[model samples]
Target: MRTWLRHHQYAFLVALRRLKVQPFSSLSNLLVIALTLAVPVLGASILLAAQPVVREIPTSPEMTVFMKQNSTLEQAQAFSQAVGKEFQAELANVRLVSKEQALKQLQSNPSWTDALGALPSNPLPHAIVLTLHETPDLVTRADSLAKTLQTRDGVDSVLLDSEWVQRLAAILSFIRIGLWILMAGVGVVVIATVFNTVRLQALNQREEIAVARLVGATEAFVRRPFLYMGALTGLLASALACGLALLALTPLNKALSSLAQSYGVQLTLSLPEFSLLLTAAILVAILGALAARWSVTRSTQY
Candidate 1:
């Protein structure tokens, strides 16, 4: 065990010494890794940042069912109750706003209050807000429910205000697809960057590797140091990426916080995602080192 430890310790020292001797080359490789990793890291941040905003979206574009001008209180109340009973299974939440409540809401608006002072009677009608379970069947179910509401005695129009919601959903879908494509493209670049670095390192140390092999060192023994060095490089690059992300976020936070404060909210980078990014970086390094090993082995004379 002591002998094995000494061997590994020697290899690790050698790797460090090589980096010290080739500082510029090592920095260039680290920069390549950092640039390549930045794409996925940024992509992940965007996706995470959208999560809270997406949750808030359902409230913004909900379906509003308005009663007719001539709608009697009894009839509107009965209709709302019936719809609630029928949709209890599929609905997420339902709210019935009576004409009196609607009037009070409008009166809270200065312009509406001034206009109401001129009118003898309230022009606002009772309304119902319906929130549905987010499912694949939502649109079809909502359409059918809207048709049912339209034919009701007191309903003015079953205004399914889902147009904006649908548009938002489409946009989010496009973003998700675009993010995946971006990740895949950048992942390929990261692999290539590491592979080239490792290949070059192998070439420079060919004489040392040949001597090691001539002394009966196994391929795994010869490859271990390069793999460890590659892993360390990737881990360092990921750390640099985290710092870059934080630096970029400073300006964005100032701008976003101004808007978010009004909504009782804040935007932030999900720090938990750094662990995932680090893991991805490590995997990329291992794969790249193995690829380099395979290529070098095929061409190596020893």
Candidate 2:
């Protein structure tokens, strides 16, 4: 086992030396892989960055129902209950904001506190804020739910904040579709890159390959060095891609911090993202190697 390991290490060093001899050739291959990987990574990062904003929109885009001045507490509670039942699956939760709470909120404002305090009666009406669930069809559901709530007794009006929800849903949909398309396109590019690189390697080593076959070297033995070369090239490309991602993320992280602070959210890419990225890199290398091996094997046979 020890001797076998030493021979493998020697072979790897031989491959490395061979790769180093043709510096521009390896660099070109690496650049191609980096370019291919960058597209999907950029698209995915954008999608991930937009997630916090998209999620917050659903929670914030709530329907505010104002009660008629004449409506009693019992009437308001009953109406809230009906809404809760009707949208049990659609809504996250609902609560009736009392008149006093409304007054307190208004009073808390410095501009209106002094003048509002002078009024003999609290002019604020009871309101219900209906929080909706996170669903793709949230906007349509909100509209339907609003129409149902508008007809309830003692309900003055149902205001569905349609604009925000609609915009958010549209943004999320676009991100998802665009990311998938970008990923698919990147996959094709990587395959083409590996194919071209392998084709060149096979062409250049045709005489050597013929000599190896005459010496009784198995096809796998002839193919092994090229496979290793392809994998190494891909690995180098992935490293460059990771470096580029970090470079791109520096400004992105700063912007995300500012956005988080503004939106009162802790928006940061978690550890899982790093793991997935590493896995993606390794997968790119393995897939590229397999593609190169398959191409060479098909073109050079016993």
What lDDT score is found at residue 109 in candidate 2?
A: 93
Candidate 2 residues lying further than 4 Å off, grouped into runs, are: 1-11, 49-62, 65-143, 149-158, 161-170, 256-272
lDDT of 2 by residue, 121-169 (tens): 9888899999998788877787887887788778889887666666777
Model 1, poorest ten-residue lDDT window?
293-302
Q: In order, what lDDT does every prediction score?
A: 0.74, 0.78
Error of 1 at 204 (Å): 3.1
Per-model TM values vs. the true structure: 0.69, 0.67
For every candidate in turn, the CA RMSD to the true structure comes to 5.1, 6.1
**What lDDT would candidate 2 get against the real structure?**
0.78
